[model samples]
Target: MLDVKDVTRMFGTKAAVDRVSFTVTGPAFVGIIGRSGAGKSTFLRMMNRLTDATFGQIMVDGTDILALRGAQARAWQSQCAMIFQQFNLVPRMDVASNVLHGILNRRSTMQTMFNLWPRADIIRALEILDRLGIAEQAPKRTEALSGGQQQRVAIARALMQDPKIILADEPIASLDPMNAQIVMDALKKINVEDGRMVIANLHTLDTARRYCDRVIGMRDGRIVFDGTPDQLSTGVARDIYGADASFNESATSTAIPTDATADRVYADAMLS
Candidate 1:
């Protein structure tokens, strides 16, 4: 379980994350939905100590995350892996090498600095790539892959950490509709099949509803709503995104197509 108690992050006088409190128990695919500068990214960063909270405590399981220092802090960060919007892969490196980098926290500094991974770690990286349906691309450079594939590689890298939680910060904001759905499906798979908690900062309402088991709506550095997808009605969405905001056609509707149909649509979209 993760407990966030009165967590707040202040930049000078401005509060980026304001006295937020929440508890997450068990594995869940959670989506943090908000418009730009709603403090969603800041909240997620604080969870992994990427950005320190000016006040309050974040306890993961029985340990206070804020109390960890040096090696312990690095270990804690490994357990709570993060995925970024930019993918963050080395453009020139092969996919396998990129995934293997996840084990750096567990490796000696000399070994990591020299890029010398053990055989077992190499095998594990390949397995993760296969599991993510991109094993064939292992030999290819990360920059050569499509946006969706690159994102999957990023996820594979996170999985290699064997993390207890995965925090994705607006992971699919750069992709097209097809790629977005694929990435969401991959995240949902991790949450369901691997039983890992996935907390993503989602840009679109439709993607959040399609994949997340729970949705957290944020507005101006505060959590406005927390509920299941079904509870997030149009009025609530309006409240979250603001009344004058315009959404895509699919955003208002919650009924998404089956996986097979979604793939077909993607194929067609690509062809067109």
Candidate 2:
């Protein structure tokens, strides 16, 4: 679904993302794991052209994203929805309206002026909310929802775009364990059932191993490891994040119960 070749990004003399390359086939869930300042976020943003690369190319559906401009870039971005660590919803808008914002690219100023989302779009948004199991909260103010619900609302908004690729940057960073599971599960279902490609930058190795089909480890702006979850044992993690990688050992217990509200998270995504 996406191809990144020798992608690099620099800030004057500093290289934030350095010569990273990878391929993402459709219906795959890929995780990027790294410590703080490791450039994982820079790498993901480059895929959407959110940050122009100092060097390298990103190909999505055969078009070189680096070459696109204006409407073309906007069109490409619309096809690649991004979910941030902080659910970036409008605080004053109702949950449903925030989700509908995903299709604003297809709506006009007049339609948007009156919040007149088409019936089909509205229906689709509602369906996405239901799929995420947050349909009952659609009428609530975004700020009134719980952290997990808010993040699911963000996911629903992304789904409203009907995107080909979903980029989640530290998606569960702000959530509690239960909420994290809920958010991660939604992402997993999107990849498995919906067949959309998912690429997420993760801080926790446990989450990466739990949720990703393929794991890519980054350090100081370069990919150090890219392989199946089973391949990321303690030694490999130690190499990527040093001794602290052992901290992830606690997540090994299969006993963690899935909250009823978030059934689809990382539960079955990881290869056993």
Candidate 3:
């Protein structure tokens, strides 16, 4: 279980994350949606300790994550793997090597410095690539693969961590519609099949509705809505995005049924 209590992050006098509180128990595919600067990224970063909260406590299971230090803090971070919009990978390295990097934290300094991976770990990396449907690309350079394939390699890397939770920060922002669907499907498969929790900062509403079991809507720095996808009515979306917002651009652009007709269909589905 993950419990966030009165979490707030201040940058000088501005509060990026304002007294946010929520509890998550059991595995779930959670979508965090909001316009730019809604604190969605900040909140996820705080959970992984990439950004520190100015105040409040974050408890994962029975541990107060905010109080961890040094090696303990590093270990905590490893337990919560992060996937970025950029698909951070070593461009020059082979895909399999990039996936193996996930286990560096668990290895000795000399072993890591020498890039010495155990034979078992090498086989495990290959298995993960096969599971993600990218086994053939393992011997290729990471940068040589297409955007969608690279993202799958990134997912394979995260699996090497054996994380309790996966936090994806606007993971599909740079991909075209087809590639985006592939990435989202991969994420959903991870959550449903592996039973690991997935919390993604999503840009498109249709993607959220299609992939997430639970949706968390944020406005400014506060949670405006928290419920199942069916509860995310058009009225609720308007409240989340605002009255004059461009729905076609933000909500339907990368969505499935990507046609002019989908506009009304998406609107009706969201509103109904």
List TM-score per model, in order.
0.90, 0.89, 0.93
Best by TM-score: 3
- Candidate 1 local lDDT, 1-272, one digit each (tens): 98888888899999888888888899988899877888999998888888888998998888989878888988888999999999999999999999998877788888978889889899999999999899999999999999999999999999999999999998888777677777788889989999999999986666666788899998888889999976776667767766542433323232233433332332233334
TM-score of 3: 0.93
- Candidate with maximal lDDT: 3
Off by over 4 Å in 2: 244-272
Question: Candidate 3 local accuracy as lDDT?
Answer: 0.87
Residue 127 lDDT, candidate 3, scale 0-100: 98
lDDT of each: 0.83, 0.82, 0.87
The sequence of per-residue lDDT tens digits that candidate 2 reaches over residues 177-246 is: 7788888989999999989999998766567767889999988898989999878765676566655423
Output the TM-score of candidate 1.
Answer: 0.90
- Candidates 1 and 3 compared: the better one by lDDT is 3
Supply candidate 2's per-residue lDDT for 186.
91
TM-score of 2: 0.89
User: How are the candidates ranked when ordered by lDDT, highest leading?
Assistant: 3, 1, 2
